[model samples]
Target: MNANFAERLAELPQYLSAHVVLSMCALLAGIVLSIPLGIQAARRPRLAAATLNAASVIQTIPGLALLALMVPLLGGRIGFLPAFIALMLYSVLPILRNTIVGLQGIEPQIREAARGIGLTDRQRLWQIELPLALPVIVAGLRTATVWVVGAATLATPVGATSLGNYIFAGLQTRNWLSVLFGCVFAAGLAIVLDQAIRLLEIATRDRRRGLAIGVGVFLAVLVAASIAPRFVPPGQAGTVAAGESPGAVQNIAGQTVTIGSKAFTEQYILGALMQRRLEEAGARVVRRDNLGSTIAFDALRSGEIDVYIDYTGTIWATVMNRSEPAGRYRMFTEMSAWLWVEHGILTLGRLGFENAYGFAVSREFSEAQGVDSLDDLSAIAGDLTVGGDPEVFARSEWTATRDVYGLGAARTRSMDNTFLYAAAHDGQVDVITAYTTDGRIAAFDLTVLDDPRGVLPPYDAVILVSPQAAQRPGLAAALGPLVGAIDDDAMREANRRVDLDGDTPAGAAAWLDERIAEQ
Candidate 1:
C-alpha cells in the first residue's frame, strides 16, 4: 500500500487552510455580533429574551438544513458565503446566552458601587461589567468554537472544499484512511483553537489588560483574512501569466491545467487519464480527484478545474435535478436544454459506455424467490426488505419510479452505498439500489434485475463543461477524442481494480492511461 501517512499529512495544509480560515471567520463574526446583543440583553430583560430566542431558533435547525437554506436565499453559487453565514448564526446562540447569563450574574451591589463612584454608563460597562464577564464569555466562545468546527464539516455537501471532502470521498471509495484523515484534522483544529483561546485568557487575566486577548484574536483574524485569497490561489495566479486563462489557448507549452473528478472510481480514473493525456500533449497537468459531483462542477465554473469527465445521465438527473423516462436521446436532449438555460453548461458529447441504474439481489434471494424484473419483484415486495443510500429515497427518479412502477418491499432502509451493497450481498437485505457499472456487482456475484417498467433513467457516461469553459480555445479539441472511448466492461473493471483489488486511485489512473493510450 502506497498510503504514505506523512504524504497525506503534508497534503493537509491545502485542505485545512480553507476550513480553518472559514471557522475562524465565523467565530470572530459571532463574537463581534453577539457581545453587544448579549450586553443589551443583560441590561434589558425583554431585549435579552428576544435576542436569545432568535439565536435559539437558529440553533434548532439541523446544521445541514441551515447550510442548504442559505443557498437559495443567497444564490447557491456563493459556496463559502452561505456556510460561513450559517455557522455564524449557529455561533450566536451559545455566545448570546452565556454572555447574558454572565453579565446578569454580576452582583447588584457591584453595579451600584460603580455608579456610586461617579462612573458613566459606558465606564461602568467597560470598567466593571465586561471585565467581570470575561471568564464566562470565554467559556461561551469555547463552546461555539467546538460547535462551528464540527458543523463546518457539513460545508462540503454544499460544494465548499473542506476537510469533509475526505470523509465523503472515502465513504464512496471505502478508503477508511481518507475518512480517518478528515476526522483527525477537523478535531485537531478545534483543540488547537480552544487551547489558543485558553492561553489568551490566561495572558490577559488582569482587568486592565483583559482587552489584549480580544486585540490578539482580532489581529490574528486580520492576518488570516489577508492570506485567504492566496490560499485559494486566484485564477491565473503565480504560475499562469496575465491574459493567459486556463484552456485559453488551443495548446499550452508549459502552463498547468487542473482537472477534477467526483469521488467514484470511474470518475477518478477518467480524470487522471485526462491529465495524463494533457501532459503527454505537452501541457503540465495537475489532478484534483475524488471531489463531489456538485463541487467538481462548481470548481470547473470557478476555473479552479479546467475539465474532467462526467456522465450525461448525471447531468440530467443529478445536476439538473430533473426526471425523464429512460432513453439516451431523450435524456441527452432534456439535459442539454436545461444546462443551457440554467448554467450555460454544455455536454461536449457522450462516452461510449452506458452506466445506467439497476437493482441487485443476492443470488440466493433471486433463485429462491424467482425474482428477476422489477414487476416480478414488486409482487413479493411486501415480504422482502430493500436497502439503498439515503439520498435515493428523496431523488425524483427513485421516488417517482418507486411509485409509478409500483416497486415495493416489506420495509425500506437507508444506508450509505457501500453498506447497502454489503447488506444485499450478506442477505441481510433482499434487494438494493445499484448501478450497472459498479464493480461490486461482480465482486458479490449479485444478480441485476431488468427494469421492465423502465423506471430507471439512462445514465450514459457523458462529459459536461461550463459554456464559458468550453468556448475557450483548444479545450474541446483536447477533450473531444476521449468521448465514447469506454464501455460498461471497462468501467466495471476499473472500479473493481480499486474496490476489490485494493488498488490506489493513482494506480488505477495509471492503468487507465495505459489502456487509453493503447486505444
Candidate 2:
C-alpha cells in the first residue's frame, strides 16, 4: 500500500521458498513411510486400530506445544530440520489413516478376480488395489500438504525464516499490511500446489498414467535443485579455513561459538548482530536461539552455547534467586558480582539498555480509578483482569511483586507479549504485565504504576559469556566498546520506529549501528 509495503513484499520470494521447501520435505517423508505402514495396518485389523489411534492422539496435541517439547530434546536446534521433523510427525496420522481406509474400501471381488486370473497377492495389490485406491490416497495427501504448509509458517519463532517472520514482525509492530501479505502469499502457494497435484491425480487416470509419472519426476528434479544448497555435508558447518584471520582475532581454540537468545524481536536482532560480529572477527559461529531464559542459561553452563545476552535483573532475580530493593546501577553491580561467584558466569558489562518490568493499565481505566502507584492499584486490583506473557506468571518479579505490593487481579491470562498491549488498549484487560522499555506502552498511551515496594527488578541488558570464551583473542576488545552505547532513551526510540512506525528489524538494526558507531 506504500513504499514500506513494496519493500516487505520484496522479501516474500525468499520467505515463501523456505516455507515450501520445508513443507514439501515433511510431506514427502510422511507419505513414503506412512503408505507402507498404512498398507500393513490395513491387512492386520488390530495393528491398524492401534496405529491409527496413536497417530490421532499426536494430532490432538497442540502444534506449538509439540514444537516447544521438541526444542529441548532437539538441543535448542533451529532452521528447517527440527520444524521439518515435527511437521512430518503431524502429517503422518492423516496420510496413514486415509491410506488404510482407502485400501480397505477397495472391493473384495476385485481381489478374488485377480487371484482367479493367476495374480499373486503382491500383483493383486499393485495392479488392482493400489490403482483403485490412488484417488483417495491423493485426497489424504492433499489434506496433509495443506496442514503442513500452514504449520511450517510457525517455524520462524525458532529462528527459521519462513512466512511466519512477516506475521511475527507485523504483530509486534502492529503492521496489519505485512500480516495480510504473508497470509495471502501462503494461501496462494497452497492453492497452486493443490491444483498441481489435482492435475496429476486426473492425468494418472487410465490411459494418461505415464504422463503423470513424468510430471512427478520433473517436479522432483525442480525440488532437488532448490534444496541442494542447504544439505551441505555435516562437518562443513563449523569448519574454518587455514590462516584466514577475521577482524583483529586470529585462531580460536578449535571450537565454533554459538550465541543464543530468547524468542522475541529485540532478542533475535541482538543475537543475529552478535553472531555477525563474532564471525567477522574470524571465529566460527553458530546460533542456538529462541531458547527460554532458564534453558539458555543452562545451555551456556553445559557448553551447548558459548555466550548469550541476558538482563542483569533477570540474573539477579531468576538465576541468582535474589531480589534488589535498589536502582538500576546498584542492581547491575550486585548482579554482576553475584553471577561470577555463584554461577561462574562473567557479566561482560552492561549494554546501556534498561528494560524494567512494570504493570500497565489503560489510560481510561487509570484516569477513571485514579490509579497511579502499586498501592493505588492494589485497591482496585480485585476488579481488574491481568494479561501477561507466559514467563511473567513464574518469574519472581511478577508473582513476588504482586504479593509484596498487596496487588490482586480478578483474573490472569497468559498471552503473547504483543497481545498484552492490544488487550489492554482495547479494554479487554484492565491490567497487563509490561516491559518499561517496550515501545507499545507509550504508543498505547498506557500509564505504568509506581513500584513503591521496589518489588520489580531492574533489567539491564548484559552479555554473559562462558569462562572459556573470555580467553578468545580480541573478543572482549571487539565487544567492550558497545557497553553503555544503548541506554534507555536510544532503545526506546529504536523500538518506537519499529513498533509505532512499522520499520523493519533490519532498518532498526542499521539505525542502532549508526548510533553505536557515532559514540
Candidate 3:
C-alpha cells in the first residue's frame, strides 16, 4: 500500500472511537431521560399529547439547523456537547411515545392484583408493571438506537468527528470511495446496534436466561467504556475538536497553521492548495474543511482557524449587507477596509480570477433569442424561468437583479447545487445562476449572458487570515506568491479534474501546486 494511504488507514481507529463516543453517549442519555417522562405522561393523557406534539415539532427542524442553533446557544462552541444535545432531542419522540404506550398497555387487573397483595405503587412499578413492560420499552430503545445512530452522521458539519467526516469530505472533494466507506460503516453500525437491542428485547421473555446475561453484559461493557471517559479531563478523552492532533507538534518549517474551507468543491481545492503551499514554505498545516457559507468568517475571528479563501463579493454582500455594486478594485478596497476594521482579518490579495455569478442559457437559446445581456433576458423575462441554489433567491445580488431587470412574476425554481447544472442542461430552466468559472458552462455549451448593470459585485478569491496568524513570522510573505497566479481557464480546469474527471481534491491540489511551482 502507498504510505499516505496506510497513514489514513491508521487514523480510522481515532475517527471510529470519536464517532462511537458521540453516538453512544447520545443514545444512553436519551434512553435514561425519556423513560420516566414517558411513565408520568401515561398517567396524564392530556400532558402526553402535548409533550409528544412538542417533540414532533423538534424533529421537524432539519438536523443541520438544529446543530447550528446550538453553536450560539452553547456560546459559539461546536463539537461534542452541541452534537450530543441535538441527537438526544431527535431520539426523544420514539422512546417517549413507546414508553407511554408500554406503561399504559398494562391491564387494570394486574395493577389491582399487586395492590391487593399489599404492594405499594413504587413496588408494583418495579416488580409487576416494569417486568411486563420491559419488552415494549426495549422496542423503543431499538427505534431510538437506530435513529440516533443515523442522525449522528449529520454531526460532521458541527465539527464533531463522526463517520460523517469521511462522507462530508468525500462529497466536497468528489471522492466517491470515501463517501461509500462512510455510508457503509455507519449503516453497518446501525444494524449491529439494532440487532443487539433486539436481543435484549428477546431476553425479556422467560427461559432465555443465557441470552439475557450475555447480551446484558455486552451492553454494560459497551456503555461502561463510553461513560468512564466522561469523567476524565477532556484532553484525555481520546477525542478532540479541530486542531487537537496528538503530540501537538510542528508543521512545515516547525510552524503550524490551520486552514478553513467552506462546503463546496472549489473551496476544498483552494484550501488544499493553500495548505500545500504553506507546507512548501516550511509551515506545518492542519485543515478544517466543510464549514458553512458564513461560518468561516466567525471561525476566523474567534481564532478557531487561521486562514481561508473567501470571495470579495461574498464579503461585500453577505457580511456588509450592501446592495450596491461597484467596480472590482473599489469593492475590494471597501471590503478590505471593513473587514480589517471590524474583525481584524487581513485579505491577502486576489488569486487572479473572478468567479462571479452570471445568468447562463444554452448557446442555441442565446443565439436564437439574441440575448447577450441581462437587459435582453429581462425583455423576455416572462417567457423564461430561472433556477438556482436557494441562496441565489435570498441574496442581495438576486434582489438587485430582480428589481433592476423586472423579473417580478417570472417563475423561480430553487434546488440543490448538485442538481442546478443538470436542470439547466436539460432545459428545465431557461436561465441559471452559474458561477462564471464553473467547468460545466463549457461542457454543456452554455452562453453566459453579460451583466451590463453589474448587479453582482466582483468575486475575486482572496486569502483571509486571523489577526493572530497575520503576526506569525513569514506567513504573509510565504503566501504572497499565490496572488494573481490562477486565471479563469486555470480554475475551470482545476475544478473539472474533481467535478468531471473524478479526481480527489487533494490530488487536484497537488497537481496545481506542482504546475504553479514549475511556473
Candidate 4:
C-alpha cells in the first residue's frame, strides 16, 4: 500500500467518528423538532401550509449555500455547531412533510372509533394515529438519514471534521484514492443506517416487540462504537510522530494553536507547512482546511482560528474594498495597519512570494494570434472565450481586468481551479486565469500575458495572526523564522510536488522544510 494511503487510513477513526456523530446528531435533532411540529400541523390546516412552505423554502436554498450562510449568521462560528444547524434544518423538511402526510392519511373512522371507546384526543393520537403512521414516518427518517449523511461531507469548508476532509483535500491535490475513500465510507454509512431504520420500520408495522428491541439495541451499539474513539485519553492514542515520546519536544508545550487554509493546493501545502512547524514547537495544532477565502479571514478576525496566510491583493481588493493602485509595499503597510486598527489582527509580514492571477494561453494559440500582452489580446478579445474558477468571475480583479483590457466582449466560462489549465491546453478555452505559482504553467507550456495596463494588484502572500493568538508566549517566536523563508521558486516547486509529482501536502511540506533549512 502507498505510504500516503496508510497515513490517511490512520486518520480514518477520527474522520469516521466525526462524520457519524454529526450526521446522527443532525438527523436526531430533525426528528425531535419535526415530529412535534408535524403533529401540530396535522391538526390545523393553516399551520400545515405555513410550516410546510417555510421548510420547502429552506429546502430550495441549495444545501451548500445554506451551510455557508450559517457561518456569517452565527458571527463567524464554524465547525460542528454551524454545520449541525444547517444539516438539521435540511433534514427537517422531509420528515416533517412525511409526518403530516402520514397522520392526515389516517381514516376518520379510526379516530371516531377511538373517541367512542372513552379515549381522549391525546390517547387517540398515541394509540391509534401514531401506530398507523409508523411506517411512513420511518420512511421519512430513512430519507433524512441518507440526505444528512451525504450533505455532511460539505462540512469540511466550515471547519468541521468529517469524511469531507478526504474529498476536499483529494480534489485540491488530485488524489483520487482519498476522494474514493471518503465517498465509499460516507455511502456505506448511509446504507447501514438506512437498513437499520428499515428494520425498525418493519418491526413497528408488524407489532413485533422482540424485533424492535433487537433493532434498538443494534443502533445503541453502533452509536457507542462510532463515538468511542473520541473519549480516548490524549497520548494514549498513537503519537503523531512515530517512535518518539509525546513529550519529547516541548518548545511551545501545553499551548493549543488553530491553523486555517483556503480551498486549494497552494493553501493546503502552506497549511501543512505551518502545522508541521507548530507541532515541532510542541503545540497541539488543529487545522481547519478547505475554507473559502472570505470565510478564512472572518475566522481569523473573530479569533476562531489562530493563524493563516492571506494575500495583499485579496485584503486590498476584497476586505479593504480599495481599487486605487498602491505600490506593493505601500499596500502591505496600509493593509497591515488597517487590519490591526479595525479588527485587532496582526500581520506577521510576507512569506517572500507572490501567487498572482495571470491571464494565460497555450503557446500555440499565443504565437498564432501574435499576442504577447493584454494590450495585444484586447484587439481580438471578442473572438475568444476566457475561463476561470468560480470565485474569479465575481472578483474585483476580474472586473478591473475586463474593463481595462476590453475582455468584457469575450465569453466567459467558470470551472474548477485545477481544470483551468487543461481547458486552455485542450482549446476548450482560449484564455484562462492561471495562478503564477502553479507548476502546470510550465508543464502545459503556456504563456502568461503581460499586464501592460497593470489592472491586477500585486499578490504578496503574508502570514496573519489573530489578536488573541498574538498574545500567546512564543507564538511569534516559533513562526517568525518563516516570514522570509520561501521564495517564489520554492513555492512553485512545493506546489509542483503535489500537483505533478503526486505528493501529499504533508510530504511536499516536509520537502520544502528541508530545502529551507539548507538555504
Candidate 5:
C-alpha cells in the first residue's frame, strides 16, 4: 500500500504545481485589487460598509458554483481564466476587511505626530501608517492564503487541474486513500503558506533584517511552489489539457481529435483512454475533462469537443427525454438513431460494460432489515433516507423510480457526489443512489439493491464523436479497438485504482492502456 501510495505521489506533480500557481495568482490578484479598495473605503464609512458587504456576499457563493458561473460570462468557455477570476473574487473579502481594519485601527497620535513633523497626509500614510498597519494586513493575507489554497481544489470540476482532482475522482470511485492523500496534501500546503506569510509579516517589522530576509522569503516561496509539481517528472503529467480544454490541435500529421468527459471517475478514465488511442493513431488529441454530463453532448454537437463517452440511460432520460423502459440494445439503437437525426452526432461504438445506477445500503443495514432488492427497499421506503447528487432528485429516472418502487415517502438529501458513500456508510442516509461499478460497494461492505423492475435505465458506455470529428482520416480505425475492449472487472479495477488506490486518472488510464496493448 505504501509503494502504491508512493507511485501515486509520483503522478501528482503537474496537478500540485498547477494548484500552487492558481492559488498564488489569485491571492496576488486579490492583494493588488483589494488593498486599494480597502484604503479608499477606510476613509469613507458608508463606502467601507458597502464594500465590506459586497465582498461578504461574494464569499457566500459556493466555490464550485462561482466557478461554473464564469463559463458563460467568459463567452461560454472554461479553464484557468474563469477559475482564476473566481478565486480572486473569493480571495478579496478577508483581505479587504482586514485592510480596512488595519487602516482604521491606527492611533490618532501617530498621524498627529507625523503632521507635527511636517509630513504630508500622503507622507504619513506611507511612512507612519502603512508600516504600522502591515501586521494586520498580513494577518488578512494569511487568511486569504489559507482560503485560496484550499478552495483551488474546486478548480478541477471547471476543467482546471488542482489537488481536488484526486479528491473528486477518489470519492466517486470509493477510494479512501486517494481522498485522504489529497486532503492531507492540500491542508499541508495551506499550513505551510500561512506560516510563511506569518514569517514574512514578522520579518518586515524590522528594517535592518527584513531586506536580507525578503530574498530568502521569495526564494522559499518559489522553491515551495515549484517543488510540489516537479515530483512526478515529465511524461507522467496528467492530461487535464489547458486553456478552456482547447479547441482543436494541428499535430499528429495535421489530424486533430478532441476528447471530452463528464465529471466522474469513469469519465476521466474513459476520456484518457480515448485521447491516448487517438494520439497513437496519428491524430492530435485534446482532453476536456470534468465537463457536466449534459455539457458533453452539447460540446460534441457544436464541435467544441470532438469525442466523449456517455451512458445509454443518461441519454434516454436527460437528452432524449424518453420515459420508456427498454432493453440495452433497443435503448442504444434508438439513442444512436435519435442523436444522428437530431444533431448529426455519431455513436461510434459501445464500451463493453454497464455502469448502471441503482440503490444501495450498508451491509449492516441490509442484513438487519433483510432488504435484498429495490422491492424490499420499496416496502420500507417510508422509513429510510436516500442520498444522491443534487440532480438525482429531479431527474426523470428518479421520478419514475419513485413511482414504480413506491419510494415517494423516503427522506432525501442532495449533496456533492463524493460524499454520498460516506453519508450512507456512516448512516447519514440509509440508502444512496449507487453506481453498479462503484468500488466502494465491496470495499465498504455495502449492498446494492437489485432493480428487478428495471426502474433505472440500462447504461452502456458508448463512444460519441461530432459529425466533423467523424470525418477525420483514420478516426474510426483509431477508436474501433476500444469497443468491447474493457469489461466490468477491468473497468471496475481501473476505477478502483483511481477512487481508492490514489492513482491519478492519467496514470490509471495509462495502466489500463498497457493491459489492452498487451492483449
Candidate 6:
C-alpha cells in the first residue's frame, strides 16, 4: 500500500496485458506450427530426426541470446515481432517432441482397424490417431505453456513489455518489491494457463463435453481480456494525457515521442527525465526501457524511438568500430558528424557529464597496495581477480586496456552491473570496471585507478535525436535547454537516490529536475 508499491501496481495492467498477450500468442503459434510438423515427422523416421534435432538445437540456445539475435535478424525491428518469434521457436521443442511421441505410440491395431473399416488415411488421422494422441499432445502443450511464460520475461531487453521489466528494473534499482511482483504474476499466469489446458486435456480424455466447452470459453475470455486494452483510446481509461499542466507548451501539443533507455539505473533516471521534459513540452511520450545498448541505438536509427541518451565513446567504439583513442572534444565532433552523415541521427550535445568505465578497487586496497593507476595495478595484475558487467569484457575498450596494461594474467569474472560494486567492496573481486558516475563509487569509498596510457575512450553522456524526430515541431526547442545542463556530481547524486535510497526512477528524476531548475 506504500506509494512505491502502488506505483508499480498501477503499471500491472499494462505490463501484465502485454505479458499475457505475448505469452499466449507465442504459445498458440508454437502449437500451430508444431502440430503439423509433428504429424509429418511422425510419418517418416528421417524427417522426425531432422525436425526434432533442429528444435532441440533451438532449445539449446540461451533465451536472452536468442531474443537478442532476433532483433538484428529481423532487420533491427524490436518489440513484439522479434520477441514473439523467439518465444515461438522456444515453445516448439517440447510440443513437437510430445506430438511425435504421441502419434507414434498409437496402437497399430487401432490404425489397422480404421483402415479395415474403409477409412482413408486422412480420416484415420483425424478420427482415430489424433484422439488417442490428444492427451500426450496436451501434456506437451502444458510444458510449452510454462516455458514460453518463463522465457517471455527475458523479452524486456528486446523492447517487448513483459513481467521481465519488473525484474530488470528491480535488479538495477535494487527494488525487491518490483522483482517479486513480476515473478509472482508471471508464475501465476503460467500456472493458470497450464491448468486451463489441463482441464481441456481431461475433458478430451474423459469425453466430457461440458468441461471442454467451459475451458474453451475460459480461454476465449482470457485472450479477449488480455488484448482489450490495446483498443482503448489514447488519453482515456488507462492512458494519461500529455501536457495537462498550465505551463505546458502549446506548439508541441499532441505530438507523440518515443524515448528509449538501456537496462540500468542511470539510464532509467535519464529516460524518466526526458519523458517528463517532453510531456511538459506538450508531447505525448512513450517509453521503451530496459533495452540493450545496440538495440536502443538501432531502434533510434529505425525511428522506432524518437530520442535517447547515449555515450560518445559507445558510438565511437561499438557503432563505428574504432579502437583508437580520441580526446573528448574531437571524439564528440567526429562522432556527431558520423552519426548525421551515416544514419542521420542528430547529436544534441553533451549533458556536461561523462560516465566512463574506470577500473576501481576498495580504498583500503588502493592505499595498502600503492595502486593509484592502471600502471600500478598492472604490476600486481596476476594476483587479482577483476570483475565487470558481461558486456565490458567483450568490448574493445577492455581488450585495448588489457593489452596496454598487461592484465592478461588477471582473472576475469562476469556479473550483473548491480553486483559489481558490492563484489569489489567485499573482496569477492579485487577490482571492477565501474561507471564513473555511479553513486556507489563514493558510497563504497572505491578508488578509481588512473589510466596513464589513455586506452579507454571518453564516454560523454549525450542526447541523440532520431532523423524523423528532429523534424517534429517544437521538439528540438523543448529539448535544447537540456544540453550542457547537468554536471557529473548532480547525476551521481540522482543515481544514488535510486540505487541506495530506494527512490523510484521517476522520483529521482523529479529531484534531478528540481536541482536542474534551481541552476
Considering lDDT, which of the candidate structures 4 and 5 is the better prediction for this target? Answer: 4
lDDT of 5 by residue, 1-519 (tens): 586577558647766777777888899899999999999998899999999999999999999889888765665455577789999999999999999999999989887889899999889888888898888899899889898989998887666777887777666655676678789989988987887777666667765476548756774676587655452332221232222122222223346566778877888888878777665544656566777776566667767778889989999999898998999899999999999999888898888899988888999999899998888877788898999887788789889988888999998889877788878888889999887887867877888888888778899999888988777756666677788888888888888887778776777899888877777
The 10-residue segment of model 2 with minimum total lDDT is 232-241
- Give the Cα lDDT of each candidate: 0.74, 0.75, 0.78, 0.89, 0.80, 0.90
Candidate with more favorable, higher lDDT: 3 or 6: 6
Clashes of each: 5, 0, 5, 0, 2, 0
**Model 3, position 88: C-alpha lDDT score:** 88
Q: What C-alpha lDDT, on a 0 to 100 scale, does residue 1 get in candidate 6?
A: 75
Give the deviation of candidate 5 from the true structure as CA RMSD. 5.7
Residue pairs whose backbone atoms clash in candidate 3: 251-284, 252-282, 252-283, 252-284, 253-282
lDDT of 4 by residue, 1-519 (tens): 988779779878888988988999999999999999999999999999999999999999877889999999999988899999999999999999999999999999988899899999889989999999888888899999999999999999998889999998888788888889899999999999999899888887888999999989988887788788752113211123432333433435667788999989999999888877777667777888899888898899888999999999999998999999888999999999999999999999899999999999999999999988888877888898999988899899999999988878999999988788988999999999999999989988899999987898999999999999987776676677788899999999999989989998888999998887787
Ranking by TM-score: 6, 4, 1, 3, 2, 5
| Candidate 1 lDDT score at position 212 | 63
Evaluate model 1: give its TM-score: 0.86
lDDT of 6 at 86: 99
Question: Which segments of model 6 are wrong by more than 4 Å?
Answer: 230-248
Better of 2 and 3 by TM-score: 3
Per-residue CA lDDT of candidate 1, range 83-131, in tens? 8999999999989998999999999999999999999999999889988
Q: Could you give the C-alpha RMSD of every candidate to the true structure, in order shown?
A: 4.5, 4.8, 5.4, 3.0, 5.7, 2.6
Task: Residues 245-350, candidate 3: write the lDDT tens digits.
Answer: 3232222256777788876788888887887666655566766667775667766877767889999888898888887768899999989999899989888899
- Clashing residue pairs in candidate 6 are none
For model 4, the stretches where C-alpha displacement exceeds 4 angstroms are 230-251
Candidate 6 least-lDDT 10 residues: 231-240
User: Which lDDT value does model 3 have at 233?
Assistant: 20
Candidate 6, residues 50-80: lDDT per residue as tens digits?
Answer: 9999999999999999999999998888899
TM-score of each: 0.86, 0.85, 0.85, 0.95, 0.80, 0.96
